[model samples]
Target: MTNTHAAAADGAEPPQGPPAPNHESGTGGAGGKTNPAEGRVPTTHPHPKTHRTPDGLDAHLVVNRTTFRLDIKLTAAPGDVVALLGPNGAGKTTALRALAGLVPLTAGHLRLDGAELDRTPPESRPVGVVFQDYLLFPHLTALDNIAFGPRCQGATKAASRAQAAEWLARMGLTEHATAKPRHLSGGQSQRVALARALATSPRLLLLDEPLAALDARTRLEVRAQLRRHLAEFEAVAVLVTHDPLDAMVLADRLVVIEDGRAVQEGTPSDIARHPRTDYIAQLVGLNLYKGHADGHTVRLDIGPAITTTEILSGPAFVAFPPSAVTLFRDPPTGSSARNHWRCEVAGLETHGDQIRADLTGELPLAADLTTVAAAELDLHPGAPVWATVKATQTHAYPA
Candidate 1:
């Protein structure tokens, strides 16, 4: 990756031409003023003054459609990789498109490096986008695909190809450089997309479900490679993904969106340790309950009261993993666990090597037990069982 960066910096000189006027606002181009002598894209916009912003990328997009409305705020530093994580139709892609200037914002601002870019066209914005499908040109070889960006930026064909070759080597795809997109593997194609985006020297990079097209094994390999590249990126990067592990592993911070709004934004550890919404909780693999808290107990709205170690008042939330729950065919005669619920097994399924029992009765919860224990208890749907959890196993926090 370092080699790729060095090669891009060394191979193609910056764009050289008469500074194109910023056509959108009848003002000079922002952050992309061209210099004929140096052939470099200005790091800062013209009207906004030449100064770096505290935030590399700052946006508050509001788009209203007939059926869906998207409103989300995003901020990141120059070296930060922020992931927009949510379930399908959560507007992750819409937000990415808005940032890339592909979608119009009905309201709010878009700024990069202290320059306002709300009106900039997609081609004029100092942004690069890698779409979910890789979107490689089928007729273009991997080398030509990577060189496409530099060529658009006014690099000579030879210079662009040289830069592309360097990036191909860095991505370990030099051998496949001459192969067209259709001939490349999913992982290789993904790398080509990434190289093409980076070759533009964008100050703001957007990737939408960058690995969604790959198979499981290919995804694992591509994810690691993408993470390394993202870390080495000098500017702000925003990636949209529904995969919890991808968001946690690849991003410096996470912005969880639901129904077009940001529900939570924090470091991965912060979100994993304390999920605020049921969607987030489930995504992180924890059972979440909302209820009212009095002292060390929470009375769930679902009719179950959970005992926890934290003392709290008013509305609260309690979460515990399925593994924290224990199941018994009969109520234990002498159990120290303070939280117990009588439940009937609604269903059972294999979760890894353990059997996950979904229960419904006094309290609805999921319990995970070893297959051996499940067999010993003869656990099956419609069977009655007692679920127990020590109060210490649950975490309670203010709602």
Candidate 2:
């Protein structure tokens, strides 16, 4: 049977009010010509309840290629921001494209506010996309780039520019409106791209790695700005990103995809505290192990037994952070820790203010210590050490 789940954001709401005036003209005209007097775009932004489905978006997308297949389901309320997160080539982008109508779906359904969009063309769908590269028209000025969407929806040049101006002001890019794409900084260009997408006031917004183009410092600033804009948006938003921090910060919920399918989906805190897969565990910076459990003892599949406070049975998973591990130059004669493994230091590196030591031995693990401690122990690669963790430090849950 196919897996289908309805994941709701904590405070998601149904479509509210008359849609912001700056984004009211969501649909555009037939040949890029504005319909005078009517002043409205041809597209539909029906009240969410009018459609009869759920309040936000409900989609089951399946895309098949000769080399790969992607099948995933998604649901979000009007005010929710859902982040599609995974490693490279994990089908996060494919799912975003399918939702945008850029890639056709082989099967399943797509609906927004009760409208079936599986057969809708890209331009007709009430959706906007911000690609990783920004995809700005290099030849056009910032104002024109943002105005292009409004113009396509049949607004007059004057009307479109007026709307574009509002979006630019909101993005704090009014000063750069006349600048061409090449002249704008990466962060400015990204803001413009976002403004262009939002100019149409789409009922559903799709962003593909929105901050991947900016440098470290710029990313920090842009991420904060993007988060503020998203909170004010009264529509469903989905963003694709490989950065776990980005997903955790900007999204109300995270959908972790692996091997073309959604392996896990939940609020960021929930997934971080209880990751179900090794990839997620590593992404969240935890050492995870699978084992067979008998009461409080778990025999790891890789040949080690761990004692935990939780009395779980059958298959189980154990997780602990690198900080929970302690390293000693020699095995201690009388230690309160219940777990001990003789390991050889494979490598050492600075992790923030602490030093992280990579070890290989009876059990591979990462241990964290202070720089002064490392210097006192004269720690280095190829050094032999004993690693131990108290039973209380490890968390155990049924697999």
Query: For model 1, how does the per-residue alpha-carbon lDDT over 129-159 read when each residue is reduced to its tens digit?
Result: 6766666767668887766566555556687
Runs of candidate 1 with Cα error greater than 4 angstroms are 1-53
Q: Deviation in angstroms for 291 in model 2?
A: 1.5
Maximum-TM-score candidate:
1
TM-score of 2: 0.85
Where's the lowest-lDDT run of ten residues in candidate 1?
A: 34-43
CA shift at 300, candidate 1, in angstroms?
A: 1.9
Q: Model 2, 1-399: lDDT tens per residue?
A: 000011002111211211111223322223321111111122222112232224779999999998989999999998789999999999998998788776889999999998899998655677777767776767668887776665554556677678778777878888998998899999998888777777666788888888998999999999999898787777788989999999999999999999899999999998998888989998998888999999999999996899999999999989899999988998877899999999999999999999999999999988899999999888999999999999999999888
Model 2: residues with Cα > 4 Å off, grouped in runs: 1-54
Whole-model Cα lDDT of every candidate shown, in order: 0.77, 0.78
C-alpha TM-score for every candidate: 0.86, 0.85
